[model samples]
Target: MTVTETTTAPAKIWDKAGGWQGVGTAVGILALTRVGQLLMIWWLGGATSEPRSVWDRLLVWDAGWFLRVAMDGYPHGYTYENGVLQGNELAFFPVYPMLIRFAAAIGFTPSTAAVLISWIASIGAAVALHLLGTSLYSKRAGWALVAICCSAPASVVLSMAYSESIFLALVAGMFVAAHRRAWWAAGLLGLLTALSRPTGAAAALGLGVAALIAVREIWKSENRIAWQPITAAAAALAGVPLYIGWVAWRVGDLDAWFKIQTAGWGTTFDYGSSTIKFLNTTLRTGDGWVSISIALMLLVALAAAGVALTQKPWLPLAVYGVVAMILVYGQAGFYHSKPRLLLPVLLTLLPAVVAASKARPRVAILSIVAWAAFGLWYGAYLVTVWPYTL
Candidate 1:
């Protein structure tokens, strides 16, 4: 079906889900997943030799970078450690830290504000995911999307001081807005999504595709252009370059942001050479279970994404998924972070969610529970026991 036609029955589908009641149920499922993951973190944290509170564990790795940006602001130029230039807070996006600062100004500590904002955004993400699913398919698909996404292996980031929650919320909301032809909302949300992370560029590209489709339909029907979609597309397409340009102007270097990312996190886009090498080595002789598991997850995700495409999802969604996967797979970075980076790529989860939505209630529930059991525990283990960054 065309994008416009697919969204025509949203009101009927929303009523079928009981409207707000269905939304509440999705949020409730998200809450349950959060509780389960937190409990796992608490248990795992206590058993570690260097036991720390669950709160502290949630604030590790990138959380510290975000908090630093919130509290101190980005550095003016390159940061150095022992005369070696390093990645600075400039590599991190500003929206999440800006929100953290805003929340902190109202009376909470930075860490508390960071986690609180993340939790709130995660709820928003769940709501948006439900609406997107319900609009495109059915209420069952909506709930299934929420349950699967919330219980994904790296979904623990949803509750932590990470920007993924806010990014997910904005991206999903933007998709819903675009699907509904709410160009104003889509443009604004698209802008925010772009400001959230580098991956936002992929989302903006997807939005651009949606806008193009709208424009073509308008031309075919009335021999006229749709200015709203065109304007929204322009706004979204501007987001990434705007931020990068600002960084360049501020730092007096054209590629300052890219430099910072490469220096700090080894995040250069190497066209998948690094990833292929890692997979080859890991499959051949990797010793660590974690490394091996991560390699396998990457393969499984690629397969799942392929399966999703065969199902012929919405055009914008499929575009976003393809580009996002390219960015994740083509990058030369932490091998273990691929799954976390893939969390907001809704396409990868479509197969399982659709299957669950079609199954009997008892069967679906048991299947999701089994998936969540390992997913929740695996995320908890990474944060509590793994020594490296997620």
Candidate 2:
């Protein structure tokens, strides 16, 4: 049967045995990807340029700051003056750093804990992504989804000490659980997303919207939302207050979190016209394949989002993608980094995944393998070829 004729729920769930294979494949992918990333780091360490090398720069940039804060709890020290805000450390949000600090208290060093936690969360990310693909298309689609995500060059974030993997896992879980009508699970995950990343706003919004549509279907009425949807709405709302509260307590101001984002983090709105500006500059700036690839991918990702918006199962991904693009591209003074910023929203490409799954079984399997191989090599090459990033 063609994928469209089938409702996906039954045909998409793994045979009970496929679960084991999935886990094995996930482990293998994670190991090799992480090893490749680390090897690049080791290769860069001996270079005379030291931190100025591509590997050193990428490691030291935002990720390095996060690792430092994760290792040392923010003392809430230092005031902004003379670009000292850079050292004052007001640029980052508190959640992921808190996770690193808490994990370290139990036993793990900040860096070790960050990598370990991120690695584990990457698995969660893969599983949630699989379920999302299966929900929209088929079980075979889920396998393909997981394979691409696990190996995507951007998927390397899973091995890093960053919040993308953790946030994606939680955000993806929120949507997948909502699709299954698991109200409390969805609500809880939705709430956690709010706390995890600033982009949590987008995830929460997407989740609440998806849940409302779902609750309507479940109750066969539009007037009153079910408990799950209400819970999700509440969870999504909770982030604003939590953010405000933290800002108030730390900065002695109601809008400190967002204010710092604007004043300190360098994020601002360009309304996509600047996206054109960015595209032009990058193409003219003696750019290489990596820059061109990222610029093209960002545009393609936006188009795919239109396809995602039509279906309920994929709607959350669409909403998140649109919101993410605006937020990232709008504030993006640096156009070169869009790949890492937006790549975590892999579900935004669901239509493509679904279309690929429509192929005959042998072709589908081969397509998945090729995609994974590309991700592995491409991601490795990004770091290896440049050697000085951030």
Candidate 3:
């Protein structure tokens, strides 16, 4: 081979991997956001009467549930507390906890393993987000996407023993693979994404849309059908049902999973009635700043999703964003958790990232840093001072 070919081959591979510089920049931006947020958490924690260490704080709320799952495994039936059904480890997905269990088996404590897995997954998420953005837009947009997402409100979960980081990484990577028409990777990632969270159902549906689009284009142009996209879509679509079916079989009830969720967390699809009522009441008479802020954030997310539609993003992404928002808005659950749930709705952040990518470098950096300042602090405050489950 020629000397030019030898050098260019590695460059081509690196470019396909989002380029060394692009991925490095994205991870660097994520590191800064995480550090700033951790410091904020420490400061806020110190102000409390019973100060908790940052490490301890990261293992609070849902972290405990994940740890239980990692160490003890899921119960065979529903849990009851004081004769009332309660949410249990079954409500949590298995993949994150499974990884934690694996890590712990290698010698780390369960808590340490959980936190370590989440942090590692978050870094993977940064890389995936960068690749997705770079593929859809540009390197600047990729870096901006990583910066915006890692510092968004409730992004503290990325640093905690939570599954959001793993879910985000898989979902973002799945999207990137689908966009690039890598059927094998897309299918595997999609299946894994589905197993990570209930929201994976929406993600799988989005993958289906992408697959259909690819199939249609291929059929029109090549006069022959491509089976890979269809097969990938089928694999993706099966993930949610597969898990739900397992839960049902284990509990010997068809609706066991849904019942557990509803009983434990009051999580059920209410067709947005609960969301509407919450917003109406919060807007009219809610006195708490946190509640007010959450309500506002929900509204802003809806507006942003609408604006994103106007930008005509890739159809699959649009479908995922719309369905995911519907799921988030249409559910009856913890009111404060909406922002965290919305963090992976990359569509909502598209306009801002696109605009930032087009702006002067200094302007973009300043804008993102300003956003990170508030976003990171908001997340830290939620974990440190809000005194509730996120």
Give Cα-based local distance difference scores for all models.
0.90, 0.65, 0.88
Query: How much lDDT does candidate 1 score?
Result: 0.90
Scored by lDDT, model 3 comes in at: 0.88
TM-score computed on alpha carbons, candidate 1? 0.96
* By lDDT: ranked, best first: 1, 3, 2
* C-alpha lDDT of residue 82 in model 1: 96
lDDT of 3 by residue, 1-390 (tens): 210111101112235555446888889888998999999999988998877899999999899988998899999998898999888888887899999999999999898899999999999999999988887888888899999999998799999988999999999999877877778889999999999999999999999998898887777777788788889899989999999999999989999999999998899999999999999999999769999999999999899888989888888889999999999999999999889899987888998998999999999999998999999999998888788899
Candidate 1 residues lying further than 4 Å off, grouped into runs, are 1-20
TM-score-best of 1 and 2: 1
Candidate 3: the clashing residue pairs are: none
TM-score of 2: 0.82
**Ranked candidates, highest TM-score first:** 1, 3, 2
lDDT tens string, model 2, 1-390?
A: 322332212122234432434555544555665675566545544453434443332343467667777776554634577755533344566667777788889998666777677778887887777666666566667766776666666666666667787887887777766666566777788787777776777777787777666666656644554675777768875874686577568767665665566665455676766678767866788477777777777777777766666644356666777776667777645565566777667645677677666788788767766766666656655554554442
lDDT (C-alpha) at residue 69 in model 3? 88
**158, model 1: CA deviation in Å?**
0.6
